[model samples]
Target: MKKRRGLSFSQRRAMSGFLFCLPFILGFLLMFLVPMLQSIQYAFSSMQLGLDGIMLRFVGLKNFRTALFADPEYVRTIAESVRDMVLQVPVILVFSLFVSLLLNQKFRGRALARAIFFLPVIVVSGIILEILSTDYLSASIMSGQETIGAFRGVGSYEILVAMGMPQKLIDIMIPVVYDIFNLVWSSGVQILMFLAGLQTVPDSMYECARLEGATAWEAFWKITFPLISPMLLMNVVYSVADYFTTSMNPVIRMINQQTSNMKFEYAAGLSWMYLAVVLVLLGAVYWFMNKRIVYVGE
Candidate 1:
């Protein structure tokens, strides 16, 4: 009898990946799929929570119409969120890449520095973050009476205004700068991803570039940037999703408010609309980035 053929390396790797993801696939189908389908049904109908259970009546997109046309704040909040995301994603990616580069270098207290930077990823749950923002921790770390007064007295925006920057420009930048700390805190995972990507770059590539008389800047653009482009794309997608789902996001808060007010049908419609927007934005970003990604193995 002929011997059975073994799986090829690529096939084996693909099988392993699928095996790892199988549990998640099963869990999503078993636990989430039914509820999600029900939510979609809810979005297209009117739901009343009676003593018996939820009573759903076919409404034929009335909830969607009400959410889009009648609700004053939904569209404006969505617009604001989209604008914030466009501004924030780039800043977060750049900041994460910069910090990851710094962390990748060998130095005294490097482990400590990395731990400090990554602490947010471990501890930044909704309740903990709210407590931190409300309690003395925020006052001590993020702002203080003296610090607030100092910034108001001699703020960067004031300096820019003095230097002949337009009020419109200052207005745009001030909020971004004011929330810089929050941005940095949200970058922990991206920073970790970049650091991991940097570590995967072979030292020999940099050594060869150095031998070829490449400057540090040239070497980075030619070698490091291309190698890490995949991670950059990942960070962008992750940051966008993270920003949308975070507790402080007004869109998420609005959804919660709707649910609390027993407006389930409206909330379901709003959530579906929000999910569509996120999918569209992410699809565009992925298409743009996928074209530029350099697969070193390929």
Candidate 2:
């Protein structure tokens, strides 16, 4: 064979990277990018099942107008969903990190505890979740019928009732505290991520801090928190998205309503709008947290 041309290091790396990303790029374009652009076009069009099946014709921005203004229920549903995600995500992140720290400690039955924590993720989806939330199961096991039946006989409810709370106060307190329970319930992934990050931290750093007369709280603030912050960010984004897409998410209930009502175009518009809102929220989180992320390797 003739002498082969040699590639430079950057050129070789670029080629390898591009080759690795090629499948992802192709999938994104075919599965997401194309479908998204088509959805945007369809959002401005009236869709109906004609003789030839579904037909689309342009109606400009009527869909957006209807969704954003005229469709009262859709707007209200979106607002409620946004509120829920915002409230739940931070709670999940903090709880998950704490759990991760506990799990990472040298203790008995750690593996079993981790498995127990991850059970919800497996159990709380599809048919199993549906069966669990049914009237028979709820009345028998879950105590009260609230969001996901998480707050059946908890102390929060007992305390509210003992305080002689009003009807509305009891109603709100049930779901709010149940949501905190739910947050802790689904924190396994974040815990795993935080555990991994915690593992990567050098023991020498903690040793140095201890030698410098740093207390446990001081070590956490100065060493643990900063070093593992990237994982915290990851967990935050994941928790936010997870909470919004959870089986008990009310926004999903709205989407199911739109589908059942045969408002496909409206549903599509709502989905795209919700996606934009999620992206913006994550972007805000990234922007706010980027400055605080300490590069431990540096």
Instruction: Report clashes for each candidate as comma-separated counts.
Output: 0, 0
TM-score against native, each model: 0.81, 0.76
TM-score of 2: 0.76
Query: Model 2: residues >4 Å from true position, as ranges?
Result: 1-38, 124-181
Q: Cα miss at 290, model 2 (Å)? A: 0.8
Collision count of model 2? 0
Question: What are the per-residue Cα lDDT tens digits for candidate 2 across 112-214?
Answer: 9988877777866688877777745343333325533444344555666688989687787666665555565678788889999999888999999999999
Predicted candidate 1 versus true structure: per-residue lDDT over 1-298, tens digit per residue: 9999999999999999999999999999999999999899989998887899989999998988888899999999999999988897888888899999999999999999999999988777677777886664353334423333425455654678689989887667755555766767788999999999999999999999999999999999999999999998898889999888776678988998998999888899999999999899989989998999999889
Q: Highest lDDT: give the candidate number.
A: 1
RMSD to the true structure for each prediction, in A, is: 5.9, 5.4
Index of the highest-TM-score prediction: 1
* C-alpha RMSD between model 2 and the true structure: 5.4
Q: How accurate is candidate 2 locally (lDDT)?
A: 0.77
